[model samples]
Target: MQAAPTPVLLSSTPIDLSPWLSALDSVSAAIGDIPALLSLAVEAGRTWPQPGGGRTVVLWELLASVSAIDVAAARVLEPHLDAVAILSQSAQAFPDIRPGAEGAGDEAWGVFAAEAPGTRLEARSAGTGTVISGTKPWCSLAGSLDSAVITANTDDGGRAAFAVSLRHPGVTCEQPEWIARGLREIPSGSVHFEHVPAVPLGGTGWYHSRPGFAWGGMGVAACWLGGAVGVARDFRTGLSAGAEGGREPDQVSLAALGEVDRTLTAVLQYLARVAARMDDGTLGSGAGQSTWSEAQRVRGTVAAAVERVLTLVGSNRGPGPLAFDERYAKRMADLALYVRQHHGARDDAQLGRLALKGDCPW
Candidate 1:
């Protein structure tokens, strides 16, 4: 396969991700193979750099590269990497809560922190430790992954993070009838826990109130950007093929490609800048107003750019690729659904509220 485009440089000492990229490319063909993805996640957990540990850019570039290969694979990989980072941070913040060898083991981990209305996961004190019960919504690959870094409502009515093994007898992963066309391979459903043993990671509200939370959200945006890059790659290849076939592209098609190029360029530059700030500690280390506003801005920017690229590619390429080219079609569909994680207007409104409260850089 052709070499992937070089990731945007965020540090003077560039990271050599070619090996990891090759591994990801090899697994792209087996898009839905949970075992292969889990194995890769376990390997990555041992080698991938933690966010804000001076190689934040490397972490995001790795995520983006995976998405560029296969969105579903990235969907399975990103959270595992994020879970490792979370565990690393939690271990440092509360040495007493260190996950010991389990955190650094061969197990594949996931972050199941999404909440649903009327559903709750509660953590209660049991003996000298803690246990969690109730159902957690939007838990992707819950049955396949070995463990997860979960958040639950604590006895004090505040949310806290914990590490729990999914192998526990009290855990039941419900298989839902997932009918989504995009990301069909990655099934996201609810998981029910009944007094499953859990190890607390941080104090109440530390999970959401940590700076890594914002960083992790932006890392997902990087995946969205990478999915768009895959679509853009298809668009470029289609134009070239047409030219080679004596059907020279018209001005409209070239114009659409130009628009895609500019949009992706701007977003890449933004991510690089943000990653640099995160590394240098200019963005602050807490989940305060500034960091929260910046996260919203980065996610909003990348999401908008992904949307624009999707529109340009779909409208310009027409239905040919969508109907005939499987990879291109999958990339387009996956990106459309993945970018929706940004929450569009609601996120914009949140950013607006932060700005009104003097949280924005401007």
Candidate 2:
């Protein structure tokens, strides 16, 4: 058999992740506090890393931080980091696309561009600018974020991306529509835009077509992996504390821990490989193929790892943590909610189809 083509790397260098890791550590204690989470997010934005930083560095740091912090806090903060990641790349990829002060942020930002059925944001030309009108659903941190990168349907039947201030006129953020008892800090719901003025960032289709878009998808996986880590750590701590009391840790607990460690170790290696490929601009870039597939694979793997960790932790520890441990209960709730971002069988089917088409030739 002919050897498969080796993926090429545009650059090779280890990413320095100390700065972002330290920043996240400084705020780790406050992660469970909703108000503090939002505040620290903005504070991080104010000192967001400059250009010339490698992609892996940003992604690794984000993953490490999210792993150490609460999942609810990760939900609130990850999108903001995603916003910066998106706009930062856009600013580099497209010279005309420059972020305003708010987008540059002394405050929080979100990418409110999920175009699900029944919800729409229409973009219309207004004088020299554009105005957006309609309801945008699943807008996380809608009321709290200072600004957002909104995707709206244009007159040409194509979608375009814009940077809009959340506090601007004609924008109405509604009460959170979440019924789940988790990720309460992220008040995601509908936001109505009635002629809300917006500045165009990139032309039609630029948002989805950019390689950085797929790169940002990996960032989401980083957060998922982090949540899994958080779950694993909670179980490990409990196991350790139990053992410290003089009795041997149960075999069931040990087996669960072993499985968790193995799964997480595999995930960590996968993440590192993807990060390196991402840093070199190869993992998710192609001429005609969808870049999103790479990130989707990572997301799928991490989601599975998270599920495994949750199951093992619950089965091994039973209801002790759930009934008495506040932090553990919260972590479980938050992670359960967050990992649902994966579309289950549907996503798997899509990935299978992609594989069949040779988009993934491993």
What are the C-alpha RMSDs, in order, of all predicted structures? Answer: 2.2, 7.2
Could you say which candidate leads in TM-score?
Answer: 1
Question: Per-residue CA lDDT of candidate 1, range 226-263, in tens?
Answer: 88888888899899999999999999999999999988
In candidate 1, which residue ranges exceed 4 Å CA deviation? 1-15, 102-104, 284-289
C-alpha root-mean-square deviation, candidate 2: 7.2
Per-residue lDDT over 125-173 for candidate 2, one digit per residue giving the tens place of the 0 to 100 score: 9998789999999998788777888999999999988888899878899
Query: Once model 1 is optimally superposed onto the true structure by TM-score, how far is the C-alpha of residue 302 displaced, in angstroms?
Result: 0.5
Model 2: which residue pairs collide? none
- The clash tally of candidate 2 reads 0
User: TM-score for all predictions?
Assistant: 0.95, 0.89
Evaluated against the true structure, the overall lDDT of model 2 is 0.74
Ten-residue region with minimum lDDT total, candidate 2? 3-12
